[model samples]
Structure formats: C-alpha cells, structure tokens
Target: MLLPTRPCGPLLAAVLPCLASPLAAQSTDPGNSEPEPAGPTIVVTGALESRSLQSLDTPGLGLAVDADQIAAVNAINTEDVIRYAPGLVVRKRYIGDANATLSLRNMHTTQTPRALVSVDGFVIANFLGASFDTAPKWGVLAPGDIARAEIVYGPSSARYSGHALGGVLRLETEPVSRTAVSLGAQSFFQSYRYYETDEDLFGYALDARADLALGSGGISFAWRHFENEGQPQQWRTVAPGTPYAAQATIDDALGFPLRIAAQDSVVDAREDQFRLRANQELGGDWELRALAALLLDRDGTSEPKSFLTDGDGQPTFVGIAGVTLGRSRSAELLAGLGLKGHLGDWSLDLAVSRFETLDDRSRQSDPADLATGLIPQGGIVTDENARWTTIELTVERAIGPHRLALGASYAGYAGRSRTAPVSDWRTAAPGPVRNASGGKSELIGLFVEDAISLTPALEATLGLRYERWRAADGFLQNAGARVDYRGRTDAAWSPKVALAWRVSDTSELSASLAWATRFPTIGELYQASLIAYGPNVGEIDLGGFDPDLAPERGFDMQVTARQRLGTIDLTLSGYRQNVRDTLFGQTILVAGPGEVPVSQSLITNIGAVETWGVDFIVAAEDVVIEGLSFDGNISWIDARIEGNPLNPALEGNRFPRVPEWRANASLRYAVSDAFELAASVRHQSTPERNLENSASSRCDTFFCVSSFAFVDLKASVDFGPFALDLGVDNLLGERAFVFHPYPGRTFVAGLRWTGGRP
Candidate 1:
C-alpha cells in the first residue's frame, strides 16, 4: 500500500489576506499613528527568531547550539555535534554504527522511547520497534546542513507528548538567505587492539549543498555519501576446561583448544542521502515551506574464525561454531509541508508530514565446515515495513497581559514484519515461514497554554494536555500457528505549571512542576514469542506481548538559576522525578505443558521508581587572556527502583546503564580570525550492575565495565573560501567499554569549500 499525499493549495488560499480588507485597515491607520497607542503584536519572523522565542518561553531547562559552534566541533556523525551538552549522551559505539541512541539524565541508554528527536518539528524516531535497534534516523540530516540545534529537558511543555519524558532534540536546517554553495570531504582512521586482534580501519564522507533563489521563493538541496570499514569488536567465549574443549584439537597459533578471543569479525557499511527543501513568503504575513528527503543504507558483517579439522580430514566446526555472514539493505523517505500566517488577532501554524521505511530486508547465513572449506546451510531472511503520518495545528494570540496558545495533533502508524528460511542463495527456495506480526496505532492530542505576567518582574505559566491513544489490527504468528490480538485504547491528561522571576538585569530564577504519561509501542504489544539458545544455559524461552501492560506515568519538578557576571555565565539546576508502573523485562522460571522447566523473559509493569539529579554549567569568553575561553558542565544523578510487586528483593536497586557522575569540559584559544585550537575532556563514573542487581554485579570479570575518561584535541584554519580541520580523539589511548570496548586514539582531517554571499 502507498501512503496518501496531501495538497496545500487550499490551505494557502484560505489564509491569504483579501484585497478589500488590507486596503481598509492600512489606510485608516496611516494618518492616525500619532494618536495610536502601542498594542500587542504577533511576531512572525524567520526560523532563527522563532527558535529564540521558543527557548525563552518554554518552562524548562534548555540548550542551544548555533552554526558557528557546530562548525567548530567538526563532527562526522550528526549526533556527535551535541556530545558536550549537559546531561546528554550519545551511545554511538563506533563511527559508522547505526544502532545509536540518546541517553539523558535518569534515563538508560537502551530506553529508545524515552526521548524525542525531530528535524524542523517532524519526528524522525523509528516507531517501527521499541528496542534500541529502532533509534531515530539521524542520517536524514547531514551535519553541514544544520543551522541550529535545541535541546529541552523534562516534560514541562504542552507542545510535546509523553515521549519527552527524558527530553527533546530539535534540529533546524539552514534556510537559503541568498545563493550559496558548499562542498566538504572528511577522512578518519582508527587503530583498535582487543585481546589477540589488532587492526586499523578507515572511513570517509563526501557532501555537497546548493541553494538557489526563485522569484519570491528559495530552494535548497543537499547530498551526502558515507562509507566505512570497522574493526572486530565481538569476542567469542568458550570454556577452557570443558569436556568439549578437551576433545577439540588445538590450532598451533591459538595456545588453547577453546578460549575467549576476538574472532575474524569485520563490518562494512555504506549510506547515501539526499534532501530538498523549498520556502516561499506569501504576501500579507503568510509563509509556506516544503521538504522531501530520501536515505539508502547497506551493511554487511562477516565472521570467520580459525579453521579446525578432526579425523578423516573433515572440518569439525559447524552451525554456531562456524563462519557467519549477514547483510541488510534499507531505504527511508520523509516529506512534509507547513504553513504559518496571521488571521486578524490570531496567529496560526499548520503542518502535515509522512515518514516511511520503504524497504527493510536482511539476510543471514551460517555455513557448516567441510573439507573444501565452508558449506552453505539454509539461511534466514526477514523483511519489515513501517509508515507514519502526523498532522499538527496551532494558534496563538495575546489576551490582555497573557499569551494564550492552543494546538491539536494527530499521529498514526502502521507496520509489518515477517521472517522466513531460504534453502539456497541462488534459488532462494523458501521452506517455512516462522515469525510474522503486523499492527497499527493512532494518537490524538489537544493542548492549551497560557503565559501570564503577574508583575513587572514575575511571570507564571499554566498548561494542560489531553491525549487519546489506540492500538489496533495486531496479529502474530509462531510455529505455523497465528493468533489475533484484541485492540487496546487509553487516554491521559497531563498538567504543568511554572514560574519565572527576574531578580536582576542579568539574572533569573525559574521553577516548574509537570506530570506526563507514556504509552507502549506496537512491537511491545504484538511481537511473537521465541525460544533462544545460549551456550552456558542451553535454551531460554522469551515471552512476547502482554496485552494488559500499562503505561508509565511520571511526576517531575525542577528549579533553575541563571546568572551572568562580566564575561562569565553560570547556570545551576536541580530536578527530581517519580514514576509509577515502570515497565521492565525480566526472566522467570515457568513450567510447560510437559512439566518441563523453562526460563521465560517477559515485559512487566514494575511498581515504582524515583530519580534526582543536579546540573551545573559555566561558560566564559576572554576571561583573562585576549582570545581564550572555557566551557564546561557537570551532572550527578541518583536513580533507584523504589518498589517491585513481583520481585520484592529488588526494592532498592540502582537503574541499569546510568552513571552516577558525568562531566564535560573544553578550552579554546584563537590566535586570529583564521586559526583556532581547542582541547576537550569527558568523564563518566561506573554504572550499576544489571537491572535485577544480582550477585553478578560485584565483579571485575569479563562482563564488568569500569569508569573511564577521554581527551580530544582539534585545530582549524580558514583562508578565503577554503577551510581545513584536524582532530585527534581519545588522545590518551583509553580502552573504554560499555559492554563493548571503544576504539583507541583516532585521527581525523577534513577540507571544506564555501562560496556565495549571505
């Protein structure tokens, strides 16, 4: 099925000012300016000015990164540009790894649904699945095309959904002010050493952008192609003293018959992206914008361990013990249209968007070892597709001393997932279809907000949002048996209040209280159950779909203070959040129909959890020297599971993957307008054990990861229309790990060219 396309002609026509009305209103005020008093005005400026207003009026903590700052970072991945933001972390394992997601204060890295990521108000999060594997498509926007990025903390605004429980990241693309063109290229290399494997790999990207003017409108286009080869990171583990190891013949190079070692693993990935945007200023306070984007990605992984042979010259390794190869290809598209205008005393903004994964196909082959080499075995193949459509309409006006705003939103999603076994790569003969699932979801939200000026130096804000969510058309199949699931529907009401007091000309204090609810994704409600095989524990059955799963609700409060003295600026904030019905996946032992013991992993609603944290930031420019500056932020968080009904022993356990302390600092020195150098450091404390807080947490064994810090240096020089940048990351060669060891010191260099006027 194809997604529906919308037309904006009628919307634009309706908002355009009439000829007679403009003449009557303008003429009457032309000669009366001397006597007319100032009244409330609706400010409808460009995107940059609009963002400034949003940052100031929002009732929460926020941070902004402009173009100059983004350029100074010289980041390869777009996510890397925000790495220094307070209380935010990007779980990017490597330069080209696709399974990256954002982690915020009190939120675990694996919780992909806790935060919202968007480009120009259009969501890029992959709602197809709920796991970390379904992170937002950050590739849609290249780093060179970003004009600014805004990060808002907490769920204190009526404009967003419960997905903002952790926070929101909004990326705004640069608009074409005049004819402009740019071309950029980057190359990076990393040397990795883990266990017995040591190797060097490299990656590169090519980007180009152009903007043109058309009559009263402008159009812009950007393209980027990236490719990379990554080193082996996964280590295969086998018991040394086991019976199987005793029988296995040892390879001369490997000292032991069976041991934990890095296999010959390698990954190669490629991506291509293109984006086009057009904007026009309709006469009389009306403007229209449209955008279209497409992305294509292909990735392949290969693992071929040392060959081992037994008697009769027959290779013994097979199945899970042999060579493995996997490949996946995917494509995504995003399109949207927006209109903003004024109608008398009311200002309105309307937007409609559609995002779709057109093709998602993957193939995997595990061959058995033979005398000739590796023999092909029947492989597994899967395909998935997802689509989302959203519509938003908002209106704002000033009534007396209060600014009132109201909005309505609708979002819908549909997805399909299927898996099958293939006999051969050439014939592609399918044997039996195994797991299959599909579902659809709908959401509707209405919200209102009022910002009132109670006094000359004090202000108050109140907001309320009502949301209705429904999941339907869900079905799952396993072992040739299919089941139709019942549909679920729910509604929630969220409220927020905030106050801001201007203590002095350069200082202010603010506080906010809010309550929000987050709903479950389609995958969490409809995926099929399966039995997984483990080397140490044999087989474990993982239960899927608990239709009765409840939503998570959070109550949050925060206070913030901002002050500036001379050339130094400081910000301090403290916050606390309490949550009910926290959802978590746990393993439990159950009895099958045959009285056999089975370990099942299922998602359940835990009782309660609480988190508290503090953040401090300081920035100074030209403090004591001519062109020297410093910027830094430090955060400390404490999160614990307060209660659990099913597992009483876990009453007080720290949250998994959340560090106690995290900090970032950077110092920059500018020799002149054309050259600059910077040094940065990042540190994080050790995290808790696992979610269950089992005895396994207290170990320095293979599964344990420790605290670590990293330092980086960057330098850039600009001449005429050309610029060159150099950087060295992980300068100390720290081998850090968050389940997987990070790369060693890496070197990067880039050249860029820019032309045309602003």
Candidate 2:
C-alpha cells in the first residue's frame, strides 16, 4: 500500500486502463446538447463552468457559490467558502484553525472520513486517519485564489469512491487569464469571556499570488502567511487545593469551577503555505493540469495563567499538570496531475494525487515554577509520518436519450507513529521508541452508471459500484512487547437509483436512493493502544486490536421539490439515512486470576443509527428594489442510536454534536456603484456531547454545544483595481459553544489590489 510518490505515471497507466473496455456514450452536461422536437428541458441550478462533479445526474443536485456570492460573506479561511451552503457546516473554532472539520446533514463531526473534499477533481482531504487531527488540507489553498466552490449531496453516483457517504466538497481556482499579481491582507479580533478568563484574541493574514497567461495555457503561484492566538481549548477543573481560588470558580459541563492550566491547548501558531498550478491545452480538445502545495506550521502552547495570590497579595500560584506541554512543528505536501480529453461525443478523464505528511515532531516538557519557567527535564517527542495516493479514470458518452459512464479508481494509505523520551525536549535528540502504532490500507473500485430520459418530462438513472479494500502491515508495540496483525480484506457493492420529473416550466420534483459503505482506516483497524496482563500472576493476555471489526454500511434516501415563482425561488428537501455496525469501541475490566484485572480497548461493531431531516429554503433577487436580494433557509434533523447491546444506556440517545434545528439568512443590497452592504444571521439548537445524552447536555461548558444565534454585517467599497472592506461577526455578542467557546463580537477588515503587472 506504500505506493510511490505523486506523479506516478507508470502506476497510474497500469491501473487506470481497467475502464477502457467500456468506452461508450455519455455526456457530462445536459445544457451542451440541444433538445429534441418535443422534449422537455430540465434546467439545473448552480451548475459551474465545467461539470467536474460526478453526481450531477443524481437527484437533489448540489449547491454552488460563485465569487460574487463568496464576496458577500465574511470568511476567515479557505473552508469558509461554503460556510453557509445549505445543510453544510464547518467546525472551525477560530481563525487559522488547521483542525477544522466539516459536517454534513445529521452526520456528526466524528465521522471525518465520510466527507470527501477535493480541489480541481483531485483529492485533498486527509485519508491517512479519521479524526480532527487529519482534517482536510484546506491550508494548502489561499482564500483569494478560489473562483468557485460547490457541494454535491450524498454518494448517489458511480463516479465517486466509497468515502462519499456524507458528501463531496469541490473547489476550483481562478483560471489564469492575464499576467497579473494580487495582494491581500486581513486582520481580525474578538472579545472573549468565560469562567475565570476575559480577554481578547487576535490574528492577521497576508497573501500574494501571480498568474502567467501562457500562449496556449496558464500558470499561477500563491503564498499565504497567517498568525493567530486563540482562546484556551480546555480548562482544569477547579477544586480545593488547585492552583486557582476555588471560591471564585464558575460552573461547567462537569458541574464545577475551572481554571486554565498547563497543556490547555492555548495555541499561538504561525503558518506558511505555498502552491503552484499549471494548465495547458494540447490541441484536439485535450488539456493537462498539474498542482503542487506545501504547508509549514509552528505551534507554541505556553504555561497557563493562575489567579491565586499569596499572603502579601502577590501572585504565587505555581504547580505542574500531570501531562507534558510544549511546542510542536509540522510540514505536509500535496501533488497531483490530471489529463482530460474530449473525444467527439465522449469524454475521458485520468488523474493521480498524493497527500504526504513529510515531517511532524511534537516536543513536550514538564512545567516549572511560573517565575522561573521551563526547566530542562526528561521529556518526550512524538514523531509521525503518513501519506495516501489516489488514481482514477472515467469515460462518459451519450447516445440519444441514453447516457452512460464507467469509472475506475485506486486509493492507498501508509502511516506510522512512534513516541519516545528525550533528555531535553527543547533540543536533545536520540531515544528508543517506547510505544508505536502503524498500518497500511488500500481500496480499488470500478463502477458503471446509466441515465436515460425515460419520457418527455421524466428521467431515470441507475448506478452500481464495486470496491475491494484491505489492510496490512499493522503493528502495535508497548514497552518491550509487540503484536503484528495483517492481511485483512473486505468487499462491498453500492447501488443507486434516481428519478426526476419536470412537472412544469418552473417546477421540478426528484427522488434518489443510494447504498454506501465506509471502510475502516489504518488507524481504526490497528486500534493502536495496547495493555498487558502479568504472566507471573497467572493471567492470560488479551490482544489490543480487533482485526475483525466490520465496515460501516449505510442506506441514504432523499426527496426534493423546487419551484420558481416570479422573482423568488422556493425549495424543500427531505432525507433519511440508516447505518449498521457502527464502530463504537470501549474498554472495560476483564476478570483475571490475579488481584489486578486488565482493561483494554475492544474495537467492535456494536451499534445501529438512524437519521432523518427536512429543510426549506427561500431565495429572491431584486426584492422591491433594483439592487436588493435575500436568501434564507431552515432545517430540522433527528439523529439517534437505534440499538447498542454492549452499552444499552445509549440505545435511544441522540448522537453526539447533532443539532436538531439550524437556520441561516443573508441579505445583500447595492448602496451605490462603488459600495455594497451585506448582512447575515445564523442559528443552531443545542447539541448533546455525550453518547447517553446525560449530565453534559444541560450545561454550556467545555463539553457542550449552545443553542445560539448571531448576526454579521459587511460593507465593501471598490475603486478601479483596489477594494476595501469592513465586517463584524457575532454582531450581537452572542455566546455559544461547540466544545470550545465560539468567538464573540469580532471585527474584521481587509484590503486587496488585483490589477497589477507581474
């Protein structure tokens, strides 16, 4: 599974040709071909320039946000491009957050691997592992470089891999149209307040990009520098004898006062990212694309502050947390190459990509006295390496009312992590591994899809996909003991069907049903943590990982109705998803002959979940005025665990972080030729943090999601090639939480210059 680096042409050539045998007729677009004598025309909304989305033929077509729409929002990072897209949300805690996770519908953020994110048809989402630490590589993109962003709903098309359970996020960069350079700068700040803490967190971003218009193609290079200081992500429960004054403490989810302590994830971070892309046309309706990106980050987590004082009323609180806390450095790389050709009535696409974690070293040291901080002591450094590669091929052709497509793809992952102690965490090196866990995974897929115009105003499409997945080269080590597990494989087939009808000139109704499977990642398969029982005590040893953990299987269905009325559009959608064999692992005491029992994690397939939701949207342009527009949406979702034999307490509890209600509204108006004003409002209901939905659900502390609403306002002024903007988020100072406190009353300002010679 450890395939060669990116641009692996020979490997791609050897693998992608599997679909060549079915090279026949399908068109990627319905607008490109003219309708027949009395055929009904189906107008798709938000279809971008080139149909890069494989699920275009599926019902409940995706939503799109263009440069103009993006300009109306106050975005902090690249993922913010789709922040307000219908049914989509990014768990971005603050500015410059690298671990921002994207959630879809009723799917919680914990299912990170189920969401597939791509840029220019190449996979950029981190598949090495499935957690917030392995979130999508959004840092590789600069916000100013994006031209359009779209989100396709569900895994209803054969054009996608199994990772498309939640959905797909697609982004495209601006085409290099001129030899020009652009510079952008933005600054933001927030007033944050919580128990025992009240302060301001701030950040800034700077970016520059240059594009070259080649004779027959184009090339572009971009660089971004960001620095930010965020509020503490965690706090220590304040009890008697803690560093802080217990009497002055405040309550949290766990029902206790809390104080900032060492290793609180109070991050002060800086990042530098660079990217280059080139696109060239090769006559005969063929084009080639290449992309390269690099990201570097240095994070500092300093000692926490204390409010305790001595007899003299001077600061005196000084203590050490039980965990190591210090600095970390990381670097990653992404590279991709793709070729597309238009062969008369058919189209062919081939691409290869690799996302590699080149170097990641985390150093942690024991905290010293606050006055004489950071004494050198025996510390630990965790080193990690990971990467994944993808190669894909697709052929599409259309003949009369029948359109068909065939696709083949291969994806592989390789990752390793080890931790050992060093003499000095700051600089010293050389140590033997005390613990380690690693493995490899691979998936190969082939699929076929056919869509036919069943009647004058009705269409039907059927798609089926076959996938083979395997994991090998897995090992977990503890102390001097080691265990190796390998050669585990599984296969599954996903089928999809969709029907759409154009009821009238201004209305359309559609329904879709799909079955999808999500395979366990290398991390999930390895289990990765080992515990031991003493042999001298006459106790048998229990293995660390459960190699037989089954894959997660799910069925998804949706129905949608869209109607256009005068200058307004109304849409209503309903969806349901059921999943089995959910990966819910737990550890408990196992009886042994000796006095001490053993506790080890058992990775098992032990749960079933069900989710259902409905959403309504309203949009309009020129509402009573020539330059006024409004867009609003509201949704309700229900997600709960159906059965859990091992933990029956959760048999009917709500899923973690799945809110029941959500809504968003935006209004834009043109004040003058050079000025525009836009405002937005967003809201969500409280989300439970625990599987059983018990004690933590009623609190709005560290482990809670608050039911809150906030407003945002932005004003932009443009003059020739220069633009200036000012905006405010949480305009009403709304207080909320999603584990970490959401920023409050934040103000943002930016300036950009685009019309300049390179």
TM-score of each: 0.87, 0.89
The residue ranges of model 1 lying beyond 4 angstroms of the native Cα positions read 1-54, 241-258, 303-323, 367-376, 425-431, 532-544, 591-598, 698-706
Question: What tens digits encode model 2's per-residue C-alpha lDDT throughout 144-175?
Answer: 76788877777867677778888878888765
Q: Which RMSD values do the candidates have, in order?
A: 10.5, 9.2
Tens-place lDDT digits, model 1, residues 714-738: 9999999999999988889887766
Q: What TM-score does candidate 2 get on C-alpha atoms?
A: 0.89
Give the total clashing residue pairs for model 2: 4
For model 1 the local lDDT of residue 675 reads: 97
